[model samples]
Target: MSFDIPDDRQYLESHEWALETDGVVRVGITDFAQDELGDVVFVELPGEGDHLKQEDDLGVIESIKAVSDLYAPVSGEVTAVNEALFDAPELVNEDPFGEGWMLEIDADDTAELEALLTAEAYEDQIA
Candidate 1:
């Protein structure tokens, strides 16, 4: 099966994607992840100002088929959360990369993003 793995971001083996602009990194699940999760029913996310470590438990994403834990892609303070997910969880399924973005963090170390997978590497991993 094929998945949408955008070139502009880095990815985790666990299926989270991170796109850094300036010092902030926006995060969300990969399209393959959402497809596997089925219809997203609920999302639990950290609030603004919450500090997180890379790989920390950021929140939960509940889908019709299973509940999954979302991990932090980069360590830092959460700057924003997608409140739209609370009201329309299906956005996760509909647009995992855009309007479905889960959060944005002011990265503690922007260099950390270098450790993440490139779109080609991620596509290979999922393949």
Candidate 2:
């Protein structure tokens, strides 16, 4: 199967993607991740006030295939979360980059973004 690796976003080897806008960054699993997980049934996200450390567990994603830990790509406070996922976890499968985005972070350090892979590199990594 094919996958989308958006050029505008930074990707983790673990398959999460981060997109920065202004000072805040949006975080979510990549299409490759969701597809591999299959039919996401539930998503447990960090609360708005929670702090996440890079490479630490951020939350859980449950799918028909298996449950997996979602990890943090950067250290930051969760400024907001996607309330929509609570009602429709399948959004992760349907639109992994758009409405399926898990949360927003007020990044403690944007320099960490440079450490993430470019879309091309991620595609090769997945391949």
Candidate 3:
């Protein structure tokens, strides 16, 4: 399956994406990524206060078909995890860019965000 890259976010080659706002960065799997994973069954996420570097593995997301690593899109300490996903993993498949966001981080590199792909670039990447 293929999914459209949203213009509102910055994308990584590994399929994670981040939305920068104020001092916080919201992280999640891209639509293309969740489509590849099929039906999500579980998501194991980091706790608040956990520190992560850019490109670091932060947690795991399990689909009905496979398990995928969730990477940090930027360096930061985790501020919150989406508690709703604990019960409804399909939230990732149903609405990845909205309620399916994995966590919010207290961001460390705002300008470094420029390194990520734009929506056009991300779509090109999968093509």
Q: State candidate 3's TM-score.
A: 0.95
Q: In each prediction, how many residue pairs overlap at the backbone (N, C-alpha, C within less than 3 A)?
A: 0, 0, 0
Clashing pairs in 2: none
TM-score: model 2 vs. ground truth: 0.98
Model 2 ranges with Cα > 4 A deviation:
none
Candidate 3 per-residue C-alpha lDDT over 1-127 given as tens digits, one digit per residue, 9 for 90 to 100: 5676789889999898899899799998988898889999999999999999988899999988898888888898999999999999899999899999899999887777888888889998999
Top lDDT prediction, candidate number: 1
Measured against the true structure, the TM-scores of the candidates, in listed sequence, are 0.98, 0.98, 0.95
TM-score of 1: 0.98
List runs of model 3 lying over 4 Å from the truth.
none
Which of the predicted structures, 1 or 2, would earn the higher TM-score when compared with the native? Answer: 1
Shift of residue 63 alpha carbon in model 1, Å = 0.3
Q: Cα lDDT of model 1 overall?
A: 0.96
Ordered by TM-score, highest first, the candidates read 1, 2, 3
By lDDT, rank the candidates, best first.
Answer: 1, 2, 3
State the lDDT of candidate 1 residue by residue for 53-94, as single tens digits: 999999999998999999999999999999999999999899
